[model samples]
Target: MIAYYVHHQGSGHVHRASSIAAQARTPVVGLSGRPRPAGWTGDWVDLPDDSDGVDASSRDVTAGGTLHWVPRRHAGLAERMRRVSETVARASLVVVDVSVEVALLARLHGVPVVVVAQPGERTDRPHRTAYDLAERILAPWPVRPAGGWPDGWTAKTVHLGALSRFDAHPAPAAGDPCRVLVLWGRGGIDVGPDRIAAAAAATPGHRWVVAGPHPGPGAWPANLTWLGWVDDVWAELSAAGVVVTHAGQNALAEVAAARRPAVVVPQRRPFGEQDATAAALARAGIAEPTGSWPEPAAWPALLARAAQRGGTGWDAWSTGTGAARAAALLDGLAA
Candidate 1:
């Protein structure tokens, strides 16, 4: 059996893992601090959440800039690694999506590592070490610009494109109302309702809807609707004429699958991860990057520009066979 190490910070990691695991040709086990996702078709073992009692001021969490989030003197970190180390004997390979320390740990234990790559300026020493130790690196995006790294890192990577839970969902029905959807990830972002209200007020004609957590106080504007964490997000996404979302990998894949035009507002991430994706979209003419959340006046033009571009062009971003191909790759690795 192969072990899949999914990062617990955001829902995207688990979403990607679930899609690939569903199509895997071999048995797979999931390891994360998160609870077992609802539809994962594999054995799941919960690892300790490393943030518990983690005080960055107290100790060098980065191990003096050589790693990411390896906080010593933390109980959670110790237990988490211990649990992860126990799986070394049973697994032939470990797919990390993604944590550098875990990838290094798996490699040290003699299990081959498939390191999932995120788009960004990951030329840092920690990232270079992880990629160097990896047997393979899986990138979940279409082939595009490499953010200026050594050719060795780029050579080993297999660009598997994007994967999403809504991959099987059909294209959104045509002729939906002229509305704008603001989608956010479960991963904490700073896009506030007050800021959204200002934009919603500017585009009074277009109905504005928001998904994910926005715990700000105040009754919303009449034109704006807040559907806090809906189960049927695809329904909302499908019915919209334009989607305003962050440039997250999962969100982009879902938008690509829904076949709706989108205005991508990239959230600030470590190593400028989302910024790199937004730039790629601009370069490919798939979507335009607003750089940051647009001002109230900028909303009208941005939304209109995205609508005019249309969503059919996203076929290149998500070919609907990414998960199948990734699963086949993992199967070959297991063999």
Candidate 2:
């Protein structure tokens, strides 16, 4: 049996975990702070309701424009842990995804942990301690400068490369006309309705798809297709000529694997991590940063540049086996 600790921060964590779990031949359960997305194949423990006003760390679902945060019920954590303990009691190993408390509890129950994280995202001391407790730390990026990781963790750190949906399918057909994919995850804050409308109106010739939690029904423009949350986005990506999206790790990884070019619009926070991701893609010459939207001229030029560099030495990252490799390392720790 395997237990997957899901934070429900963004779809990226769950999205990556699903691909990995598909390769696993074990019973897996998921626990999240928010309601599970559609088609999750694990036993779920729903989080407490948040009827109160939004706080600092709240997640804004674009559809209703409401900010969501992990509910803090005194009984909730305890109850969830009781369930986790029962599951872990029969598990060969536990895989923790960026949750400090979950990692600690798994250790308390004598279950070895496997951590899934991007390279520079693991700077926290608690996470470092979790890395120490884990049999292996799986990083989904190329072996560049070791940023944000603790020293002497090299023995446990494995560069499993980028975990992506593209790895599950063949690369996009060569020589397709340029189409763009625009993904906005931290919606309402990052990419607003007006901006999406402007972009859609500006570029009529290129095909575009906007995915993420929908901001609202009437918010979308007719030129762009809206998918609330996509279970499989690769078919659209494979058919696309370019990707115009938020600087999500998953989005970048997918486009990179498809060997397509991208025009990235960095998310202005309240939602962090977009800037780093966008800048990295820009530096690699796969995508460029478009600070503001509604610029039809700029987008075409950026997309053109991306297309010229398509399928050019992009797979030099890590092999496409991060999850299974990480899982095997975790199993050895339990042994």
Candidate 3:
């Protein structure tokens, strides 16, 4: 059996894990702090939240600043580690999506590990340590010579080219009034309510749909529709004339798969992850980037430029077979 460790930070990690697991040839088991998503066929272990039960006045959550987190005297952390150890004991391969401590632990237990690589400035000691210990590194983008990856790291790395849950889903038919879908991710976008309203007002003829966790400040324009959180993202994408989104990997992959033009706004991320992905997209001429949120006045020109691009160079990034390719790699490792 193959074991997968899904990070609990955001939905992206779990979403990517589920997509890849669905394509796995061997039986897959998942462990995460988040509850198992519906339709997950694999065995799941819901780990207790490590941050829970911590006495802030007394507990040191950082484990002496050596690890990202290992709460002091926390039963959840102990139980979580015990479960991971148990899983590693029986599994042939451990796929981490990702955590340095977990990868190290798996390696120390003698189980081969495949670590997921994200676009970022990840040359720090902890990241480097994990990369060094991993048997293989899986990158979900097309092969690129950038990101300043350390020497010898690429030899064991496989580029799977943008995995998405909607790879097999049909694209939505184009809608009238040129619907522009504005997507905000889990962490929220930097653009404020005034800017979003200004953009809606500036683009009079088009329909602007705002989706994801951003509620915006109070009321919105008549032309703009706010969808707090959506389960049917593909429907929105299909109906869109253009997509305006944060440069999150999964979101970008989905947009590319739908063959829609996009304006990618790079939200601040640790290790410059979003910025790196946005830069690569701009360099490839796949999407237009606003280094920060663009001014309301700049919306007309920016959207026009993005529409002109129209998913021209995105084929290189969104092959729609990434999950299959990633599954094959994992199966090979298990064999």
| Predicted candidate 2 versus true structure: per-residue lDDT over 1-335, tens digit per residue | 77887766666787677766666666667766667756667676564433344443443322132212234443554566677677777777788775666676787888777776553355555556677777667777766565555676776677777777557566767635646667555433455666666666666776667666665667555667777777667766777777677666676677667766667776654324567655565566555666656364555566667667665445764256766765565545555
TM-score per candidate: 0.97, 0.78, 0.94
lDDT measured at residue 45 in model 1 versus the true structure, 0 to 100: 84
List, residue by residue over 1-335, the lDDT tens digit for candidate 3: 99999988767888889999999999999999889987899899887777776775578665565555667778888989999999888999999998887898899899999999978887777788788888899999998875577777989888989888888876555544278898777754677767777899888878898887655567778888888889888888888889999999988888877878899999888889999999888788788987988777788888888887777577888888999989988999999
The parts of candidate 1 lying over 4 Å away from their true place are 175-177, 216-219
Query: Which segments of candidate 3 are over 4 A away from where they belong?
Result: 53-65, 170-177, 214-217
Estimate candidate 2's RMSD in Å: 5.7
lDDT (Cα) of model 1: 0.88
| lDDT of candidates 1 onward, in order | 0.88, 0.63, 0.84
How many pairs of residues collide in model 2? 4
Say which candidate scores most in lDDT: 1
**What's the distance in Å from true for residue 228, model 3?**
1.5
lDDT (Cα, tens digit) per residue for candidate 1, span 1-335: 99999999888999999999999989999999889999887899899878877778777999999998888878888899998999755899899999999999999899999999988889898999899988888899999879577788788888888888898887877535478888899777868788999999998889988998856557777898888888888888988999899999999999888988989999989888998999988888887678898889988888888888998878888888888898999999998
Cα miss at 313, model 2 (Å)?
Answer: 4.4
Candidate 3 accuracy as lDDT: 0.84
